[model samples]
Target: MRRIGLQLASVLVLLALWAFVAAMRWVDPLYLPGPGAVWDAFVRANSCYPITEGAARKICGESNYYLWEHLVVSLQRIGVGVGLGALAGVVVGYLMGSSRLLMLLVNPYLNFLRALPPLGYIGLLVVWVGIGESSKYWLLFLAAFPPVVIATIQGVASVREDQLLAASSLGAGLRERVMTVILPSSLPYVVQGIRLATGFAWTTVVAAELNNGIPGIGGLAFQSGVQLQTALTIACILVIGLVAVALDQVIVWIGRALVPWQGKEV
Candidate 1:
């Protein structure tokens, strides 16, 4: 909590400095709008009005327009991509960790793919899949899958060999040994991967949206900045950060639930 408070205080101080610089014309207000301008834009944006065409367009006055739809669109992409990637990572990681033959055959290819920069594929993906939700999801899945797979592999390999040997000596079959020992021991690493994957998902979602002309938070940010609405652009950036943090917290909560020992340690 202290860390979070300190980080937020630092952000507030930077914002204050920025506002002062712009207000005093040390920085061009057009280039670095004051905090007041940003807040006014944010309020208008949240009110579902958005100050379109440099005039107020409140829901009451203009019937109905809202950020909710855009928010929902972005959330849907995040949900589907993260879900698919995490599932695949866990399964493949388990296989590679437990099966020596599989690991030898797969690790090189996996490493090569992981080494590639994620954003480098945006143009190719757009060309192959077209500018649509499908491409967006594919990009996000690529972003998330590698970390989970690596964590699972490490977790499984890190388990004590003696435990498995003992289980085998007691006439425990492969499935029983895995259930009682491997899965339980490797859970921490797997959870860690999920946490990392959440961050990856956010980056992929924004990049995909921006490059592909998708109508999501990234698109909104791009549109606002292009139209010279610096406040709205900054608000969109804030919204992205908030969403990433929320997703991260949810993952942490799940980790604590699954491994109650963590709570005890805390």
Candidate 2:
């Protein structure tokens, strides 16, 4: 109860500060809009509005590339990209960790790729794959893949030799040892990697949507900025942040369920 109260109070303080700054015109309204302006923009985004440019004209709300559509598109891209990347990273990381020759062969390429900024390859991806869903997926995959791979490798390398010895002394076969010991021991690191990858995936969404003009939160935000709709842009940014937090919490919940023993200090 106390913690919740404190959180609420903190939010209230921030809101108060924002209202003050906006009311005082500390920043130009074109660049910074008040909470009320943001709320109006949100309402407008959700409500039916007329388009004057069409022959017959039509009322459009969120149905025509609105908030929900943007959210869904972004979520789908992130989900598919992150899921595949994490899976592939785990496999490659395990192979590299288990075999010195494999590590030697793959290390240089992995280092080079990981060192590059994820968005730096957007132009290359657009050229190779076109400005389609495939490009966005590849961008997000690159954003997520490296962290997961590095984390998995670190996890595998951190496994204590005594644990392996114990498994061997118990007459465990290679498969059994790997399944029961190696995988479980590495799960905490895997979860951490996934959490990190999720954030990276979200961060990459804006860059992925740059030229593709895909219906996503990032694209909406970009459009809002281009139109100088500061309130709408801020609203879109807030939505993105809230969604990221919610997704991260889901990942945390899954991690807790899968590795209940994690952080127990046993």
Instruction: Report the number of the highest-TM-score candidate.
Output: 2
The deviation in Å at residue 2 for candidate 1 is 5.9
Candidate 1 lDDT over 50-112, as tens digits, reads 356567653521113234455667888878887799999999999999899999999998898
Clashing pairs in 2: none
Instruction: Check candidate 1 and list the clashing pairs.
Output: none
Q: Write the per-residue lDDT of candidate 2 for residues 88-115, one digit (tens) a residue.
A: 9999999998999999999999899888
Candidate 1 regions off by >4 Å? 1-8, 48-65, 211-214, 262-266
